[model samples]
Target chain A: MNTELVLFGVFAVMTLVSAGLVITARSPINSAMALVSTFFFLAGIYVLLWAHTVAVMQVLVYAGAIMVLFLFVIMLLNLGEAAHRGRPTVTRILGGASAFGLLAVLAVTLGRTQALPAQMSAEVQGKFGTMAAIGESIFTTWLLPFEAVSLLLLVAMVGAVVVAKSRI
Target chain B: MVPITYYLLLAAALFCMGMFGVLVRTNALVVFMCVELMLNAVNLTFLAFARMHGALGGGPNAVFGVGHVSAFFVIAVAAAEAAIGLAIVIAVFRSRGSVNVDDIRTMKH
Candidate 1:
């Protein structure tokens, strides 16, 4: 097998397994820890896709800052092992059925698309997914969205502080 | 070389898992984590499509196409969501003394 395929297999397995743990682990802290691992593996997949900038941001934001917030809340709340709820109900069963049904439809649709080229062309392999390319486009063509996102971040920061300040 | 469809399929599976988690888990924090998972899955799809379109060489440096830009925006939004979301979770915990979604039903009454 090719190296790229091998890498994809490894990362895909790791990501899915860790994601499963995130939802299945009893303690919220354990779930958060699982989520950290999931982000790391997902970043690996991003790198395989040649999205180097996104991979870096994934590590920095999701695994680093966001996870810190999750862990902090889990601790502050002092959440014990989630009390075992009763048996799954009809709504739960229906939700599962619908989610799986959606997945099936998505899979079928994707499978029907024309097959993509097996290997990236040299020109794209060289320049695509590079930070320079992304930065150029972000500043030149996508400048407005970039500015808007910064503003949104500012608002979110202020709002979070205000919301969390009441108890402090 | 891996097929782009493989990446898409993987993303779909991950998204399904996240959806399942959201549906089954009653804990608000775990549900939020599932939401994050769903977002990441969507990011994977974006990057996969970016790679595919860039390979077409439609323009100079089209490799880092609009998909990358959109994915970046998604990540930024996710960060903001996490911040605000966790803050809400904390506030809820303080008010109700429980983080379970079932315990926080205010609209029913």
Candidate 2:
């Protein structure tokens, strides 16, 4: 019934609805656009949770840069609505059942669990969640993982070029 | 204080919606979007824990380590994930000439 809950509820709904649209929308472009909205809603939720840094990165990275790349590819390819209609594949059925099972497990776990007692009431606010703090941490304590991620990106980049580029 | 349960529940719902999208959507691009949704859901979980633990100091110092630095680590990873994932999806679409999962039936019976 408070501001946090109100914000969470709004963003939650936005996330769900846009995510649904991401699947059901006919055009790939439409789905990608819906995904942008979904990212925006997610960023809002992150803001509500006091994750100012993650929220900014969510919009800038996912909704802004990544999405622009997606749009470019979509336009370059000029992919139309897929010609063939789908019939259920075994992968889908199995995947759906597994998802259902996971959902049930999570529901039971959360429904029965008690809330952890609040250890401390940190009333911290914004700007502190800026890029600088994130950068410092990434370079210091998380340097190894950070470097690993860079390596992963490098591999992925090479792989993508290999996969997409026309044979010489 | 917004109970952590509420955030967890929201995360669960988002994850489920994303899972459903991955399963039901024929378009590879939509599937990719769904994956992003799932990642965002996980981010919510991380932020919730970060707040509960005082690890990120709730705002400016909102981080993930002993000294409130791990939070940025997660965000950096997420960025890397998005970049790599979209690149792969784009590459796959280019080669296949379609973004429909159903179109890639080579793995099927």
> Which candidate's TM-score is highest?
1
Clashes of each: 0, 9
Q: Write the per-residue lDDT of candidate 2 for residues B1-109, one digit (tens) a residue.
A: 7777777887887888789878877876667778877877777787766665653343333243322244444555555565566666676666776666767877688
Least accurate 10 contiguous residues by lDDT in model 2 chain A: A117-126
Tell me the tens digit of each residue's lDDT in model 1 across A1-168.
999999999999999999999879988899999999999999999998889989999999999999999998988998989887725889888888888999999999999986563366676577777888889878877889999999999999999999988855
Candidate 2, number of clashes: 9
TM per prediction? 0.94, 0.83
Q: Candidate 2's residue-wise lDDT over A21-119, tens digit each?
A: 887888889989999999899889777666677788778888887788778877877877766656777888888787778888898898887664145
DockQ of 1: 0.66
DockQ per candidate, 2 decimals: 0.66, 0.44
Number of the top-ranking candidate, with DockQ as the measure: 1
Looking at model 1, residue A19 earns an lDDT score of 92
Q: Pairs clashing in candidate 2?
A: A128-B60, A129-B60, B28-B99, B56-B61, B56-B62, B56-B63, B63-B71, B64-B70, B64-B71
